[model samples]
Target: MNKPVLDINDFPSKTQLITLSFQHMFAMFGSTILVPQLVGLSPAIALLTSGIATIIFLFITQFKVPAYLGSSFAFITPILIATNFGENPGNAMIGAMAVGITYSLVSLVIWKAGYKWLMRLLPPIVVGPVIMVIGLALSGTAVDMAMNVNDEYSFLHFTAALVTLFAAIVFTVYFKNILSAMPILLGLIIGYIYSAIIGIIDFTAVKEAKWFAMPDFLLPGIHYEFNITSSILLAMVPIVLVTISEHIGHQLVLGKVVNRNYIKDPGLHRSIFADGLGTFVSALLGGPPKTTYGENIGVLAITRVYSVYVIFGAAVLAILFAFFGKAMALIQTIPTAVLGGISILLFGIIASSGLRMLVENKIDFGKNRNLVISSVILVIGIGGAALRFSETFAIEGMALAAIVGVILNLILPGREIVQDEDEIN
Candidate 1:
């Protein structure tokens, strides 16, 4: 591993801290706000809760892991399904609380029983296809936003979307260092400019917004009634399986970047519990589910700064920015076509990430069992297969796919080949 400019425990000068923190905040800003925007939650709330969650996460891990928490893309479809396209977000919050509790319970199990069994239960074959399903499932939504204006096809809107998508792709593929890490932000900016020039953007919201004001906080039982339905819970809970797997993968890669075994020093259970707690707190206050952001990780890898203090500073900055009413308003003014254009790349990257996971792990598709698991998960999840217990309750789409994948992984008969191969290796 390359030597870090600043080690994990080393704090930079106060001036340096502010600068680095802002940089870190900027790195995570685009992706962090995108989730809530996509899911019909408050961008301000997402920023605020993410900052608080990062503080909580750092404290829980003894301030050892230099990770910044942000909104998770994995929950986009689930949040939409649970909330009835954001009309009943309170139900989604209830489901998010359940997800948090589930994480806590699973953490306790890992603390007691070790995480090896958990790994076995969710190997690459199970995880990879489920992730693919998540991205593929949202492809239609992305296309709609790119091509349509209020459900009607508009040539101008489609052109704007294409421009945004093209910019994001260029940044992602051609740039290096910080710019390369922020394809989403760059794409949005370019798209916003194009939209504004085309007279598609309405700046009325930004103009009328206060410079400083409280973000619209959607408190459960206050803004919306706490209506917990079985269908919402079912829609949301199974997603934990994929997110947990994603968390573990991030920890492993982060350990490599910082040259510290985070799983051992801070402990996987602690980090995971922090993640769950962050999501819980974020949801309790009407933000989307929080996760460790890869964008910030990219920042760390590029900058070679491993200081947790920097991460903390970034968290603080995010919190402050959340109260900036004009900034929040500006984010809201972003055109749907622009978002759709960016989503084209973002969603495709998600699906590609899943396939990359399979390739990286060298999953043997030549084997019948392996092929069966992947095929079943992809079809069930992307095909919108559901196991409905009642009108009000059903495990459908990605959730159903994940549950079925795990079961199939366990009961399938080709375990001996892997075990024998393991022994040989």
Candidate 2:
């Protein structure tokens, strides 16, 4: 695939840029808004960070690729755990933001070291299982949330969630074009509509919500007096590991769309560091950590618009919207059941994506070593078994999965190692 011209000087006219920008914005709409809502973070902050992150990403990448950064769903489990430990939602936001900043700083070092070093240290063998565990770890939370929609524990709600989950999978797996690309969002929409028809949606919040209000921006403050330094670090490491994969994917997509391998041109290290910078900015402003949004990659793929300027325009619009009070209000007005219904799709995707990773990596589950690693990783992670060393060194779920997978990969050497060079390359 030939790379297209993407320099700002070579972009289409202003009118064309605005139109393209709107398309990019729409691409990000469902995923960006849903991340905050699903994770119990403020939608307003999410919107703002997304906008800011997009701009910063462009600046750091020198506007080389038409990409937009948005709230990362990867941090949802960590945020949820932090919240449980008595971190206020706002404080949790601060913690997550801090993590993003930390990631950004770490990314700089990784980027400078180049992609070879990254691939060497974190091979597919390690990354593949870690990803599977991430999904497994959070699976219970998905079911738990699904069952809690009615404010009462009911098998009916779980059934409803399962239905929503399956519907999303079907649509995403089989649907063509834009619909196929947005199965998670589409699933939520479909589920919400179904719930609404059943009279489960509460319109009171929507009705009472102001037309506009300033997105609540708070200074980053430390909370949760209990210091689980080790737990926080454990949570932080796995996040960084997976985020690096996400970073690579985003850059590769942009490179393919724009007709340039910016990963090799400006370098993957540069792009990762750029992503870190964007994350740092997002953290400062009290938004969920930002990453290059794959949704935007789909948008670029479909539109064939490679103009970075247009993407920058979209970023500005997001920042402007962040300042608007009414937009945030409308986001808040989204009902819990509606959100829960959407979550059924979102969290399920998180799990399914993991399965995709395993299959794509050609992980040999037939082998005893493979089976043991995969099985233990899945059970411990999904079952939410916590491993504690006093308190600071507690490991649970995704972090546990990552560690277990790495350890198993090293310890249980495959007897029949059929290396799939194609996937590995």
Candidate 3:
């Protein structure tokens, strides 16, 4: 294992702390803001609440786990569906609150009964295809944004998207260290520049924006009416299974990185409770759902800095950034085409990650049950199968697929086959 420059409890000088914290902030900024932008929430609110969420998470975990919380990509499609493509984000917020509550409940269960049951419930066969559906389901949106301008096909926009995608791929594949971890931000920067060169970016928002102002926070009962229903719960709460799985995976990897058994020390229940609290607060204040950021984890791996204080400092920085109205405006000015270009790569990576999960787990496609589980999940999820209770409500797409996958996994035989094969090997 590589030696860390700053150990988890090591405190650096003020200047060092500030700089390192800023680095962490920069690492998470791109994806953090991108989620809300895609789902039609305020990027400023995303930044602000993510900062708040991180602080809450750190505090809840006793600042022992050096993990940064940011916007969750897993909830992108769910958020959009709940909000009606940003038409009613308050509904999405309610759904997010439900997700947070679901997390808390799950944490309670884990605390009392242990997490082995969860693993049994959502095996790789169920989780992998659901993750794939998350990315694949958004493929059309990515393509549409990459190729269209104002709903019309544009050659120049397509060129810009291609350039952005190419840059991201190059950075991800060829670069080492921190640069490799920042492919999304680098691709966005390059794409933004290209869009500017093509005279597609509008700078009026940036110009007219104040230097310091409050982020546009959409609060329930203040900005939009708060409403909750079975539809909202059904739409959002089920995705918690995926995100919780993701959270556990992150904790395991982070434990390895920091040379600490975080799951045993801070405990999985504590980390998950913090995550739920973060998501709950973020949603209460109109930000995207918060999850442990992979980018910051990559940063930790590269920089070998594991200080929770550094993570704390970064959270502060993100909050301060949210108040920088001009910067927020600048982020808003980023063209849809540029975002589209990056989303093509970003979303594809998401889909590929699911496949990687299946491969890494050595999910036996040879098994009839395994094959059936994956097949049903992918087709139902990506094919947009829905269980409609009413015109206004339905469990469709990813949520529907996840529920179906879990049920199939539970009922299907051959669960012991993989375990038996592993034992024999």
Candidate 4:
């Protein structure tokens, strides 16, 4: 099916602009908030960062690109591995800031060396498996949360989770229009309703919440260390590469959506630099790392509204919500079972993206180099193998897998045959 034709230059009245802006906001609401719930981060911070990041993205793209930055799924597992939620939660974000800085460096290289260099350094073969590992690693965590009721298995909790998962899947695959765009949110609604019915959701926080409260911001970059046992900063450093690959891919998709060669115009350098700065700034404020949102793009494709102003309008609304204590409190009331259901699907999709990357690039698995690299990375990553050097500094998980894949790709001789050069070109 073809998407409705949208004229990017089409100007709208204030009323239409407001309506479109709300639509944009609702479309991204589900996934944007989900990241914080899964990773033990503040939902308010997530909302606030996304809004600020989108505004920054606009500035970097010269107000020409219509992209909104939101909490990234790519960093979910890396963060989980990096921090223990209670003990060094801020450290994960500190590592995230480092990742963001790397993004800026990549932009500088692209400005001089070209994007093909990035493609070779982090190709589909390497990126594909690393992405898969990010998702697979967290699968167990999702399942455990769904089954456990306050750290013990409970049938009611399991049922609530199963129902929520089913609803999310159904909405994502069968529903159309606005409902289709908000599967995670809709699914969570169903899950929460059921969870409440079963006495799983605790609304005490919401009840105790005042009608108005200030947004208490948690700043980062205080205590930073580079180590293995307790250093989330080191664990999360490698995932930055995965996010960059995601950034490049998203820019190409955005170019297609806007019908402009953003890869050339504002250039990948500028686009990534914006995202890097967005992440660095957001992480410093204890917010999750930001990336270009796919949910917003889906909205663009659905409504055929490509106005940059509408997205800006949505960003403003997000910032407003972050300030609204009641809104953030309500988001906190969401049940663990509901979050588990969404995580299961969300994490799987992240993994599936890696597989799709390999297939789309037509990477030949028959070649010894390709097969060996992919297999080793997957086993090390998903199987949870790590190489620890010291108590404080070690490499493992997807990070280790990524480093190993890059080394193997570089050291391994002979190039696998490509079915089509134009696909890569």
Off by over 4 Å in 4: 1-6, 221-232, 416-425
Candidate 3 lDDT, 1-425, residue by residue in tens: 98899999999899999999999998999899999889999999999999999999999999899999999999998888888788888999999998888889998998998777777887888899999999999999999989998889999989999999999999999999788988898999999998899999889988999999899888889998887888888888889879998898798888888888877677888999999999999999999899998999999999999999999999999999999999999999988888899999999988998999999998889999999999999999899899998987789889999999999999987784333211311
Q: Global CA lDDT of candidate 1, please?
A: 0.90
- Model 1 lDDT tens row, 1-425: 68889999999999989999999998888888888888898999999999999999999999999999998899999999998898888888888888988889999898887777778888889999999999999999999999998789999999999999999899989989788878888899999999999999899999999999798898987988887788988999999999999998899888889998877777889999999999899889988888998988998999999999999999999999999999999999998899898888899999999999999989999999999999999999999999988889799999999999999999998753332212211
Tell me each candidate's TM-score.
Answer: 0.97, 0.84, 0.97, 0.93
Q: 152 in model 4: Cα distance from truth in Å?
A: 1.4
Off by over 4 Å in 2: 2-9, 85-87, 153-175, 186-197, 222-228, 366-369, 410-425
| Displacement of the residue 72 alpha carbon in candidate 3, Å | 0.6
Query: On a 0 to 1 TM-score scale, where does candidate 3 land against the true structure?
Result: 0.97
lDDT of 4 by residue, 338-374 (tens): 7888888888888898999999988898898889999
* Candidates 2 and 4, the one with greater TM-score: 4
lDDT (CA) per prediction: 0.90, 0.66, 0.90, 0.82
What is candidate 2's local distance difference test score?
0.66
Q: What local lDDT score does residue 142 receive in model 2, on the 0 to 100 scale?
A: 58
